[model samples]
Target: MWLLETTTLKPQLFLGDSTPYYAILSHTWGSHDKLQNLAGYVKIIRCCAEAASCGFKYAWVDACCIDKTNSAELSERATECYVYLVDATDPSGFGNNRWFTRGWTLQELLAPCSVIFFDSDWNEIGTKASQAEFICHNYVAQRMSWATRRETAREEDLAYCLLGIFDISMPMVYGEGRKAFRQLQLEIMKESTDQSLFAFSYRLNIGIRPIVCHLLAESPSLFRECGTIQAPGDGPAPEYSTTNKGLRIELPLAHCIGGFYSAFLNLTRKVCNIREL
Candidate 1:
């Protein structure tokens, strides 16, 4: 493990079976370019100071601890790091903070068994364990909201950064564009039994929402009887497919007032007007 020296801000590597206590830093990088040099050390310093005050001898700041130049190392660290502190505070307060909207931060929020939120001034706010009920209740919806709006420098990272949250691993293919997200989702379906993974973007027909329902309905037979099932015997499995042949419905044209018809089609193709009141 490599840690940043709290005072000197230098890198220190440790190796052994004895686990040395360390604090991990989690914050949204406002600009990717800012993280390329020591000028971005402000967050690292604050995290180190906060960790030291908490009796932690070392800390891990993602911006500095991981060598972004090395893709394999970066992916490895992202997959392995599970304990972290989220810097959620802003001048406007936690609700308006960028940390909650960044693509990479999703895993930072979900994977950590122990997560502490800190204010802009490095003051303690709350812990994930304390907010378990609220998080669990809104997990799927909140995650969907996060994934939809979060930004990433590399488009593929929107899905790559979520690898930890879904407990899926894949080779990092940087330039795959939206296909990376599709691959990520397929991996999630293969490993997970959660149907909610398909419940995304119901409000936008052009997005992943429309395709996910078909994906879920056509998932391997293993997902048919229950939420989960064992892989079939060593032979060719059944194939699944779908098509967009379009839908039609009959309704009173008089009821389509105030442009409701236009908005309805934009939302979903499966739903159409019916004559029955």
Candidate 2:
């Protein structure tokens, strides 16, 4: 079903209360075209089911949730959107910065109230080398093809797939890939900072577009985290200090692949369009 009107989805705004949690509906591939699209929708419902099992009461997904038609409302609602969904993947020069949240879109970097645990054992899957196998075995993917076009795409995707898919062997696989991806990502950021023209392109490709995707992804995360989702406010914002940190930003390949597949399915709705495996 389509999302309700913007007015209908406009959640109540609060002062100090926390916003709902959201989950990313990444990954949407199938045996055929129709099945591929159906997979995207399935991820949304699956997120809800998994979240509910983890004490979460709500979730926000873009496909059947947000009313993108209302530009005014969407933009307005976007500012305080940081309450959930901090996309670790941005083409921005800050891709490697563990402190990248500071540059998050108005839609990300907000407070979270709930969390969804998929109990995904991607690390144990035998087909960890292939993204499709990762999804088929555990069902996850958050990256889009557009983002994967960069130089670090392969290594990053490899790390993500291996990190979340393999249970025992993930450490070695993830370490090797992470090291390589980090090196390449650092080079890109350095080039952008040193050169003038390169900096401009970097902002357009990595900074802006990734921020948009992140904002959209946060919706579902907010719903899943918080008991009730709502609009954000300028009250007490979340704190992020470089000196004080924990897990750095890292979006697994499953997440990226899932997002790509879902987006593709959404773009092409050819009835059960079957293609090669």
Candidate 3:
């Protein structure tokens, strides 16, 4: 008879946290004399502090959140977390911005999710551009699934799952982005050619930069001078339709689709100005 070691196996579990909101704050490495760029680090700290005031239950800051000595543990826990704050070095670095932003904010960054952005100005900028596009995609998909395919779908349950999914999915997305980029990187390395990751990243950068820029240029009014305003509801409710048109306004919310899309695009283009710069 072979002697067997007695050990208990633990089951993997995902009991969601009760915290209503979470945030991630990040900054590029700090070096003396790098004041201009280093300003981002200060802004990140302030942003995290502001988030806590906004009722975020938890906030992760790279300076204190991660244990650099323990890669194994970091890798494991990183898989499940909420929020990922990022700051890009420059405008041309949109590819880096997209990958890291998307990677750290995965489910919400792609497919479907709620997202927020801390702009270069320290104002959170996630309303009617890339962030909105990502959220709309998910919302539509969810509505589609519930209406036509699901038998036990519940709106409350969807809300619960949506928040948690945003948390855990980000790190996984980051890993995937790294892996995909690495494969392309290796191809360039092997060829020993003029091509590089930067070259391949150009097309992506061009497309994303304009979309975001134009969207912001058009919606400067939404952001305004105030950082954020508090509304008496779960959150700042998205008003998708409005029929207040000058001389005589009379309509229900149901009849506001035409104006909604028009306002959305017009404001987006004006605030963002992707076309000009």
Candidate 4:
């Protein structure tokens, strides 16, 4: 793993288990970094400067630190993360910050065990623990909703960035288009029987909606309003699998008076913090 020495701002190599305490810098790519030389010249300097102030000897920024030409990656084991909110000048703008609207930031938001939010002036605004009431936990659909409004320059990255959030690993194939998201769903189903995964909406009236399907959502945007959807914690998830025809699953189907059966999904939603099935 490579970590930047806070004082000299030079990248240093650290092998397994010998890595020192480090803080990671997270921010929106294009605007915050100013994109001087593709290494995010301004952002890196400010990030390491903050690390040095906080008594951290080393820090990491995704842009210059990772070798995009190869499979090199930043260490995920780092527990402390510093979130640089370049768009927000004050703490009041936290809710409307551009940081929440980017695809890659979703991974950065969820991965760190501790996060310190900093304003554009590099002044401390908030910590993740300070905003506990607004954060959701554990539910699959809610976690997906967090990324629905986020975006990436590449269509494939919308799914690729989420690989770590779901604890799924797969080969990255760039030219696959929306199939990448579908493949991600297929991978998620393999590890979890959470019926909430299928509870996403179709993003009614969005511009240029993808060809809709009943089995899975075409994009994460369909899950925008699903933050309230809750997983069936102890409810038995029906056995399901993918087949040549489509997704095959055993759902409790009830026939209505019109002779149409409605399948009962093993999922619920919270209203006033109370679960309703």
What lDDT would candidate 4 get against the real structure? Answer: 0.77
What is the C-alpha local distance difference test score of each model?
A: 0.53, 0.27, 0.30, 0.77
- TM-score, per-candidate, Cα-based: 0.60, 0.25, 0.30, 0.85
* Candidate rank order under TM-score: 4, 1, 3, 2
Best by lDDT: 4
The better candidate by lDDT, 1 or 4, is 4
Cα lDDT tens digits for candidate 2, 73-166: 2222211111121222333322232222121121122222221112122111211122232222111111111122222224434333222122
At residue 241, candidate 3 shows an lDDT of 22
lDDT of 4 by residue, 1-277 (tens): 7888988988898776788878898887653345466346767888888789888899987765666654326325456888887778756667578887888877777778888888877788988788766677567788788778788999999898888889888878889999999899999998887888889877466454334356787898888778888754765666788788887888888765545566778778777442110
**Candidate 4 local Cα displacement, residue 90, angstroms:** 3.4
Question: Which candidate do you rate higher for TM-score, 1 or 3?
Answer: 1
lDDT of 3: 0.30
Q: For all candidates, what are the clash counts?
A: 0, 47, 14, 0
**Full ranking by lDDT:** 4, 1, 3, 2
Better of 2 and 3 by lDDT: 3
